[model samples]
Target: MGVRFLHAADFHLGSQLAAGRGESTDHDETLESAVYTAVSRLFDLAISERVDFVIVAGDLYDTDSRSVRANAFLEEQFARLAEREIPAYVCYGNHDPVADAPTYVELPETVYEFDHEAPEEFCFPNADAPEARIWGQSYRDRHESRSMYRRFTPADDRIPNVGVLHTGLNPDGRRYVPVGRRDLAGKDDIHYWALGHVHDARVFDDEQPIAYPGVPQGRQITEPGPGGALLVELDAAGSCEMEFVPTSPVVWRSVAVDVGDESISSIPDIERHIERSVDDLAATTDRFDGTSVSVRDPEWEVDGYVCRWTLTGNGPVHETLGADPEAVYELTRRLRRTLAGRRPFVWTEAVRDETGPPIPAIDDLRGTDRVIDEFLALADEFDDAARDRFRDEVGMLWQPVDDHEEGRPDELALTDDRLDELVDRARERVLGELARRRAD
Candidate 1:
């Protein structure tokens, strides 16, 4: 029978999700428990699927001064695997390097950690006659620039050979173990290479299969979706097949919304557009097909999603937004208040204003309107002195936060380019107001 196992990395168990924009209503526990929950899901998969073993490439913890809570969580999970007679292999990465220190919470005997001194081999089940051979090493310090894959050649490649490593995967990179793709392909005897350090899960199709399982849960908005692990099958002929299975119960998404289109003139209208976007996200299929990774449990169910919204496109709403920082901040607060209580709740992290004034072409309005033509003429003459005056007028917006305020506004840096952008926004506001009066 062929051998089966789980490949994963970058658990970062001790890290907590950032409080984006603000914390949610009735979901602080949900946010805090996400990382641990995801890790638990992976362990559940290993036992349920009855994998022969598990391999963690690296970064099992977020820091070398590991927290007792994180230590206990991992020990509990390892014990679960041991009960099923399934063993686990681990190599510590930069975040959790080997320091000649003992673990606070002892892991079960089924756990095997690779040495940091050099690349070492461990036979699966027993060394006398084994189904597979796995090799890897740990980071003695925070940085490992030396080549480790050069020593990965298996003594007997008759059975399947697997390599589990934590690398940046760029042969030229000096921080993480820089192993080139070509070098990995050259080691054709190894049927699979499990890699880590890059936090987005991806599979590279070389002569043999190489994969990065990525962080099981995202701590920040930049790392989106259900970060996960891989399920693999290996035959005696060194043939390998792998599939990605998401383990995160909480996902992060960046949603782009065109805030001030012609149809979106009111708060309710903007809310409708955001609601539609959320519905679309909820309805879309799990996104692994285009990535060329098969799914085992493709269900997209999750506790919730945190979204960072970018409001794009132009309309009359430019009369109130993007120019004054307060306008955008208030809009985000309004949105969060409206969307915080739904099932599988959607949290609005922040909203950016990229809107503009809704008006006709300047050339078209030039011949028909005298006031606009005069304003345009004066606007052309509004130079550095005028911009400096405008900056002085808006200087109060960046004043250090008041004791009454929840958070401080970003410091205003009115460089030449920024001044020009602000000047254009002022012009847009004037034109937009003029256009509204003309219709009246």
Candidate 2:
């Protein structure tokens, strides 16, 4: 029989999801427990599959300072594996490095935590007469700039050799353990590289699998889709086959719905449009059973989605929405209520009004008058100047507020994307004001 095992990483336990922020007490508990729930499901799958062993690459906890509950949950899971005689190999990532304060809780005998000093090898069946060899190393501290890949010695080529490490593959700066695909791939003796740190489920090459099983549960809008572990099957010849199993209880999604020419004149119309969009999403999820049935399958499913809705495109109700922030908030609440009232519930975390006024053609007003010409010229100037100077201008307003706060910095840094947002808002506000004045 072929040797089978589960590959997973970046559990990030004790991490709080932003989706639960400002939510009801029960909702907050659900969101907080979602990560743990996903982890439990992963263990459940491992037990059911009766895999020989489980490999957890790293970041099992969000930080060294974990809650007692998080500690208890981990011990419970490891004990479950021990009961079935299935071994677990784990390495520590930057988030839960060796130098971090100990939890004082002992892991089960079935669990093998890699040493921080050097690469250690664990053999399946028995070390004296091994069928598979797994090598791994934990992080010595929170920041490991050097490449740990060099420390790994080649295992015997006769059996399936798996090398596990927590690294930031070809990262921009030195933060976590830095290593490259070629660095590990160059090792001929290693049949598989079980990687962690990056929270996006990826398989580098099928021949010698180098995979990151991402976070089991997405904790924010940025981590969209289904997060799960990889199941690897190794034949007697040592050839491998891999499959991903979805385990996240709740999926975080950011969806944009265009209501440009949909005759949406009021908040109710916008609400209906949003409801239809949610329905479409639900239908799509149900049709594929949460996994995308396309070539570019994101491997994300939404049994229950925490969504950030963006209303896009020019519409008649644009001015109405922009004019009243309270109305938009109320609309968001109503949308959330409407979605939650339905099956496969959706919680609308946020609603962004990206709609613009249905203005006349720019060509029609180009040279009509001085005000129009001046306004158009100013808009162009603003776009160009905003790119370079908007951050400084905004920082002046933000710095004073930040300074007053205890932990806030004196200067606020803005990302390129955030700058673009500010520029778009400025342009819209200018044009809207001009149009309103002209109408007057």
Candidate 3:
């Protein structure tokens, strides 16, 4: 019989998400709870699947300084796992740096949180004493630049050694804390290497099945898409099978639909185009049971499944649709119905400045030709580097204006429109310098 376990990491509880700013406090709590809920769901899976053990790669908490409520929530999940009698192994990632620190919930007898500096190995309960050694090291300090894997090697042949770590095989050189594939592959006797850190799910070298289960839920735009944990079944013979089971309450998606040449004379056509895009997400989910777009409060209800929508495109759609407040109203209503009570179905408005033809070929400015050229010439006098710095300084100086322009119409008028007056003064200064340089 193989050892089955759920491998997951980066459950940044207390870390705010797009839903944090939602109008529905209940929905916000529900969505956030969905992340913590995944832990129990996975534990339930362990019980039903009868996995010998469970391994949480790292980052159990978003930070060391968690709120009292958040800590209480963490305790609840730990208790649920204890109830199932399933054992859990954990290592601290960069986020949850203090592996040694103790908190409220009575630590589950089955839980083994790894130590920071050195690699600790623990064996599971099996008649064969299956050489399944779990070797893990923790994040003792915040910025551990040194390679912890250097201390790890494969287990004895008598054991089916399994190594669990929270490092990155960053394909690009620009990875945080830099770990490489060679470190994992070079180790002998290690049949399966469980990894974390990089949120994207990946397997390196094929020689050693090293994987990162990604995050349990999306935290930001970069972390968009469905999030989940990896279910790994290791046979007594040492061969392992892995499957990704998504357990996120709400899926984060950034979809861009092309509306370049779309003709939208009526609402149904617009609805149809959006329907196809939404249907695409349904097929991706493969469950076919989610919300559909409609123009009503609480939106259209279809079997309690709610999906979200974001429309994007250029061409006639922009001109025909952008200014129509009713279109936006109708679209929002339809989206709300499709995403009914899922709460934060629509996180952001789709950017649809796609109206009008391509910027016209460079043409002479009719009345302001001479002044515009002078402005351009003055703007070009400073090198690219200097101009960039200048632009940054200008942004900082006008920071108050930018901050106030978001929702207040009066603030927007005072900041953006009024700031242009100052900008003109700065432009004059640049032109004056240009003239002085030319004369010299």
Give the candidate number with the greatest TM-score.
Answer: 1
Candidate 1: segments with Cα more than 4 A from true spot: 21-24, 100-102, 283-292, 297-300, 359-440
Off by over 4 Å in 2: 235-238, 282-303, 360-440
On a 0 to 100 scale, what is the lDDT of residue 382 in model 2?
Answer: 67
Summarize candidate 3's per-residue lDDT along 270-289 as a digit string, tens digits: 55565556544431332112
Whole-structure CA lDDT of model 2: 0.75
Query: lDDT of each structure?
Result: 0.78, 0.75, 0.58
Sort order, lDDT high to low: 1, 2, 3
lDDT by residue (152-237, candidate 1, tens digit) is: 87886778788888887668767678778788889877888988887767777777887888788888765677787999998767
Regarding TM-score, does 1 or 3 come out ahead? 1
Residue 188 C-alpha lDDT in model 1: 73
Give the poorly placed runs of model 3, Cα more than 4 Å off: 20-22, 99-102, 126-131, 171-177, 235-238, 265-272, 283-313, 320-334, 337-440
**Taking the tens digit of each residue's C-alpha lDDT, what string does model 2 give over 111-209?**
998998888888887798887888999988888776877767755587888889887675344757666677778887788899988776767774476
Which 10 residues in a row give candidate 1 its minimum summed lDDT? 400-409
RMSD of each: 10.2, 7.7, 12.5
